[model samples]
Target: MSGLVDKAKNYVAEKVANMEKPEACLSQVDFKGVNRECVTYGAKVSVKNPYNTAIPICEISYVLKSDARVIASGTIPDPGSIRGHETTVLDVPVKVAHSILVSLVKDIARDWDIDYQLDLGLTIDLPVIGNFTIPLSRKGEIKLPTLKDVFHKK
Candidate 1:
């Protein structure tokens, strides 16, 4: 069981590490012992803001891949007590910060792509999965597919 959990963790870590360069950076990731209690893990992602500033963050995501088919995971920002308010990664250029967030979500999906059926432990929900379809266009807009010619109806 522990071995399975470790394999899953490695799957996620490798996904992040393999992302296209200059857009994201991750390190200090640790997958602690796993059990029924919880799937504990810790790490930091240095997201490069659109302005090209490196924002380092410390986060822990709880993943219970063993209990449920779809695992739930979310990130918590630094308290800002140690790194100070200014250094907190969450505070940075808006677009760059957003890009970082988008990248994180994408990483999860990519990680889950591997050994998805075999593990059946990681489940990605709707909201998160929808994010995958959000296109990264320079125009900065998400165009919904048109079911009908609304413009012509009138």
Candidate 2:
């Protein structure tokens, strides 16, 4: 009886391992805008759902790091759902305080850009599988806006 139960557990584990799940990519990061207190940047995540129906997203958690320091970290609860058999683009806004950016002037002074690593977890409620998180990471440089660009009108 114990052996039969173990075999059933193994079967289920194998099935879950072979299941086709959603995939995500941190597509791009760019300068969003600047405010009085902080500068805002936007990260774009592209997610492709494989299921036949829409999957409800539980949360989108993100960590933005620079110079081995966490510049920003937060969770966006219940952003929405991913469409079935289609790709969805989600925008995550990251705000870094002026103080934080001031602390990294050395790196920025080189080329007027900041080097960053963005870590994101895309959590979704999968049928029968419960909640699953898709981990994604991206490393790149964000070019800072020049004084002219900031004051330029659209």
Candidate 3:
């Protein structure tokens, strides 16, 4: 009896492991806008849904780090649902406090850019599998807007 139960468990585990799952990737990151309080950046995420029906997005959480310090982190709930058998692009906005900019003087002095690592989790509710989270990460330098770019008169 125990041997039969073990075989059944193994079969279920193998089936779960071989199931086709959704895939996600960080497509791009760019500056969205700057306000008096903080700088806003947008991360474009692309998700490929393999199911035959739409899946509800539970949440999208993100972390932005620079100079080994966390610049911003937050959770965006219920961004939307992903279309069936198609790719969806979602924009995640991150706000960095104005006070934190002062702490990054070292990187600013080296270059007019910030070396950053963005970590994002795309969570979706899937049938049978329940909830699944796809973790995505991106590392690159984001150039700060120069005085000309910021103060340019239209």
Best candidate per TM-score, number?
2
Per-residue alpha-carbon lDDT of model 2 for 36-109, expressed as tens digits? 99888999999999988999999999999999999988999999999999999999998889899899999999
Estimate the TM-score for candidate 2.
0.93
- Clashes per model (N, Cα, C within 3 A): 3, 0, 0
Summarize candidate 1's per-residue lDDT along 1-119 as a digit string, tens digits.
99999999898778756643323333233332233343333334333333233323233223222122323334334422222122222221111122222333543454432111111
Q: Which stretches of candidate 3 lie over 4 Å from their true place?
A: 1-6, 147-154
Question: Regarding lDDT, does 1 or 2 come out ahead?
Answer: 2
Please, what are the lDDT tens digits per residue for candidate 3 over residues 48-149?
A: 988899999999999999988998999999999999999998899988887988799899889888999999999899887789999999999877777776
**Residue 111's lDDT in candidate 3:** 86
Question: What's the alpha carbon RMSD for model 2?
Answer: 1.4
Candidate 2 residue runs with Cα over 4 Å from true position: none
Per-candidate TM-score against the hidden true structure = 0.23, 0.93, 0.89
Q: Rate the local accuracy (lDDT) of all candidates.
A: 0.29, 0.93, 0.90
